[model samples]
Target: MEDSSEPFAILPADMFGQVTFIGGVSVEPLAAVGIIDEALTLVNDRLTEFAASPSFETDMQTVFGESVDVDLGRTIIDALSLGEGLPEITVVPAEKMNGIDGGFDSLTGGVYLADTSIAPNSVIGREPTQSPNLADVL
Candidate 1:
């Protein structure tokens, strides 16, 4: 059985129409959806073009440890590309705001701040780090 914990879709398709806010700035709901669709289509086209090459499939299989599904690979690439673009889109309007700066960090998979510091060693709630064994609780 495939692991349920593992993510299947690179991007949640539903996110295309969802409201995304950054520093109180928001994208037009329809525009966001259109951009996501365009990105997906572009990535898919690129993948198909690459696959047309004689050795592309074999090369990908060898490097990735499995055969690549063109559709799935396109979705993954689109998702990653969209994630990279989001910071730029969100930060554009917010750039004029005082003391606000943001950009995507691919390596960390997060946004970083230049002039802010998070409170060190802050814990919001008390919770066990591990689940309790059912037998022990019983």
Candidate 2:
């Protein structure tokens, strides 16, 4: 059985439509599935050229992980190619606005992370956030 004392809760997307993980778990499955379905539906409704491949499965990929560089760019292009417009395409540089607290030092210095690097390309559904105020609501 799951640990009863273990913290578990579903984080709803903020006013901007972004959700995130909490207490060291992945995004909630139901919420995540809904969000992705909506994004895919939006892509189909809008772009009309995207389709989910047989192997296409929604999973979390790191966004704003390192230099705000290439992998991020490719993720965005792929997401777009799938015909979805990321709900929130922009976010403040996470490192710049806040300093590291020692545990996750990968994000030390501040850097710009565009939508291509921050949204569906890197991952589907919402990103875990420390505060809703920090996110730019779409």
**TM-score to native of every candidate shown:** 0.32, 0.21
Which residue pairs does candidate 1 place in steric collision? none
Q: Cα deviation in Å at residue 1, candidate 1?
A: 46
Best by TM-score: 1
> What ranges in model 2 sit over 4 Å off?
1-26, 49-138
Q: What C-alpha lDDT do the candidate models reach, one value each?
A: 0.38, 0.34
The residue-by-residue lDDT of candidate 1 on 1-138, one tens digit each, is 232323222223332322233332333434433444454445445655665667775767786767567556545655554443332222223333354443445774434222121112111221467332211111
Q: lDDT (0-100) at residue 68 of candidate 1?
A: 62
Expressed as tens digits, the lDDT of each residue in 62-82 for candidate 2 is 334444454445566566555
Candidate 1 wrong stretches, greater than 4 Å: 1-19, 24-26, 55-104, 110-138
